[model samples]
Target: MTQELKVINFMGIRKYTSGFSIILTILAVASIVFQGFKLGLDFTGGTQLEVQFDRPADLAKIREVLEEKQLHSPVAVTFGSDADVMIRTQDQMSIKGREYIAAEIARLGNGASLQDVIRPTREQEGFVDVLVINNLTPDQVAQSGLFDTTRFGKTIVATKDNTTQIAIEKGLDLVYSQHLLKELEVATGASIKLRSSDSVGPQIGDELRDSGGLGMLCAFALVFLYVAVQFQWKFSVGALVGLIHVTIVTLACFTFFQWDFDLNVLAAIIALIGYSINDTIVIFDRIRENFRKLRAVDPIEIVNISMTQTLGRSIMTHVTVFLVMAVLYVFGGELLAGFSKAMMIGVVFGCYSSIYIAANATVAMGISKEDLMPRPKDETEGGADLTP
Candidate 1:
């Protein structure tokens, strides 16, 4: 008598596991729909100011001070250390900049009149504001050396129709930054120094957001095509669903917890897709191999054997990656917090998804030995095999 083959029946709880996955997916989708995401400056477009205090900064007090100064809805967080703080605020028009530009144009003595200073809108980009001049052409204004002063950031001269518009770049820093620095200094009284300052326009932010989303979509499509070609369409369907599940659930964690969703986090999510699909492919390959070799075994038994064989490898890989990500989350500072957090979440779900979501999906799709077996050559059509 042949010795009996032994394997853990991972699919024995298929109904329970499938229900759990479905429930989690629903909850994730609901959280994302209702709560949305707390977008960061990289996506929403805003001014970011990093300041260092001589002493440890009081984050709450800093927020209060900002409120007192009428800078509502400002986000203040501790950056690298307690003494350093990063502040982000929405778009702000620079009144002082407009006034300075107007005076400079008048002093140019070119009979140029400052018609209007229009603040940048979402539709317009690469400029803080459009300075409509009545008399001077864009080239004339540019050559006047009015904006050549170091006080301004960068200037661009352009003409739309007959009107000359002088658009200034690197906005919100010339005026708003100075005012913010002064107010923060007086309020904190800790001798704060502005370490860095940057601004991103709404148009640029929109473009980044769109591009990030497009990148994710392309990743999913490519993954599907690859799996379909390498394995069967059934395995590809399972892999695609597994990827979508992992991505959505990870994003839902961010939305529910209100973490800063920025470019770094977006990159982490894309990276996670690759990692998750890799594990799925490994398990799928094993399943395909076992299905072809274990001809006498049942479909479920073959899957169980495949999973049991790869369990140790999967555990080792995921644990190693998880530990690295955990270290990154703890010590990588605020800059990499979002990235590491996203990665950690992905590792956990990526493993689970490969086992249950992807594998179980293939099983549910009625995968069989014949599905993964190599097709026999049509000897009858190939000249009767041409054998003796």
Candidate 2:
């Protein structure tokens, strides 16, 4: 008679020991220490400067230009290799920066002069200040006039205070801001300072981080409860073990690379949990079926049999799913690239955990005779049915 094929017979290892699980757990802990996960500006709240030029620009050049203005190097990303560039600059709202902006504007153009170069920042109304410097002492004036004005027959008048003022068109010196500060210095003969216009608050990022952790906890606990209720306690325990194992491994990979952890990473984690559970369920279903089919078989051998039967299907399904995720990673654009990457890694490891970790855990979980055997038929004297 032909024998049932042992799918793992060709495979080198069939079981995962406690030692392997312990070692992986240690690695996962160390991951947190060495590779400190950094939050992205998206959840944290930072200024996002979008520059769309007529032509494609290199990131390196863009950074160099921005740094010359004293602006910190922005997190630069291009959407789908598009011509436009997105720059995330450091946050700055200090009085020092605003003070510097005023000084920088004054020295914008050497021969061209600040008046000629610095256009009004406001788009619609122009500011014309009519300061009566002759009548007032420096301390006498409470504040400088911020002239918001329009033109009259003879001269320009302040719209806000009705004071006479000068006309400065907006968007005049802004183009110079787009240029390298070095070029600005060379052309305008002024020392340009990089002013921080925006920064993300720690409160927002901290909230996200806190919520992400909570989300993970909630996700795992709920899943464990459901699986436990649906299957046996042992099945649920093993599934959770497999889950923790794969999650740690995936997180270790993330730490190893020092990739930025953000909302997207959390999304990936949730998705991974779902994906891994599906694999676990598939294997568990097979085991339940095998138990009924081979009631006489030992639990260890039965588990091995179940794993063999489902191996082909698991590999085929995960491979096809992985192929699609790979495509998404390659072409889904920068926004979703990290998410796709995490999913691909999860699929591979989740499959591994199901066969090796989950099955062995079932073995470790002691099985009673009743667990292996079906209930005996009730006789006329049902009480005596306990006889073996």
Candidate 3:
């Protein structure tokens, strides 16, 4: 049951579609400039704090408490999620702060319950630089058994009678005391202690940013060269044009949503270049074949017919890829959210540009009936370049 497919007569757009693309490119650039991006902690260093509670917690009051401690304007993210409280502050982590945290939660009656500190900026390089040397004022060890020593960070043991000692450096910055400690105990169902330093440096972020950008440029250039060699320069022009379209569209989506431009996004964009060029190649192959059959048609006519013939296939491929990307967007963890979003956007626009954009540029190269049509077998009147 091979049904005959009618060739869609698209009247076909003129070859000079580059002007339209220029407009789209302008929009993307404008978006990039006026609306900056919301960079993630991975690219920009910041502190992320996760605290759990037996009951719903109020962040406004918690921020107020931190404000009283000289740390104001903390970015809090808590919508009943595992990592509810994420604070991006300019202040650095330090020692002797654990006591202050514990005292404030109890004094303010804030039911923070449990707390875990993550210094994405510092921790990327190494742990904290500060240290905490606690010298407890006790005969030996304060086993009040009442102080719920398990809830406290730690108690110092002395060789002599009741005396005291204290020093501070940083490690973990985690404190187990008061309500915060109790909630931590209930949450983890285990005794916990704050030890070791957690810190991040700018060097790792800078290196990642540099490598990602460099890799994308190198990959794109290599792909452009390969396509140019495989097809004629005009066909390569189409493929490269489509690739640029996909890249800009994807990047614009990132900027619009304020998603961080990280290595994953960069990798996704590179993958898109390959995907877009592949579709362009499929159309170009069909156009070349049609040029042989329609010996008298303009190159633009062959391009249009080929696109019409391949439209169904293009739709099928992009739809399948889009479905998988949708799954990742919905079910994948936070780590993959950005990557999935980027892929989804690229695939959609990549297909559209492959047909409407890439082919248009090839036609715009002044392809005429003579240049587009396949040459006939050598004849007496044929050009000297052909053999008898």
**Candidate 1 lDDT, 31-116, residue by residue in tens:** 99999998887887777788899999977778887787565247788866899899877644354345555676787776777888
lDDT of each: 0.83, 0.61, 0.60
- lDDT of model 2 at position 69: 60
- Which candidate wins on TM-score? 1
Q: Per-residue CA lDDT of candidate 3, range 1-388, in tens?
A: 9987677654354434466667888898788788875555555544445555444545565555555556423344354463344444433343324555434434433232213333323322333322222232333224324223333334332222222221112243443223433444454454433222234445666777777778777877877788677666777776777787778878988898787665567778888888878888888778877887888766666777888899999999999999999999887645567788999999988887886677776776765555545457767564566545
Candidate 2, residue 295: lDDT? 75
The list of candidate 2 runs beyond 4 A from truth reads 1-3, 7-17, 56-60, 63-73, 89-200, 372-388
Residue 309 deviation, candidate 3, in Å?
Answer: 1.9
Q: Candidates' TM-scores?
A: 0.72, 0.67, 0.64
Per-residue CA lDDT of candidate 2, range 1-388, in tens? 9986854531225433566667877888798777766556655555554545444555566566566566543455675345566666544323223344345433433321112212233542453222221222222222333221221112232333222233333221232333433453454344434442344666877888788889888888988898877777788888888888888887777788876566787799888898888888888877777788877777777777778888888899899989998999887756676788888888998888887777667667864335644567767654555667
lDDT of 3: 0.60
After TM-score superposition, what is the CA distance of residue 340 in candidate 3 from its true location, in Å?
Answer: 1.6
Stretches off by above 4 angstroms in model 3 are 1-4, 9-20, 46-169, 172-200, 368-388
**Candidate of highest lDDT:** 1
lDDT preference between candidates 1 and 3, better one: 1
Q: Which ten residues in a row have the lowest lDDT in candidate 3?
A: 160-169
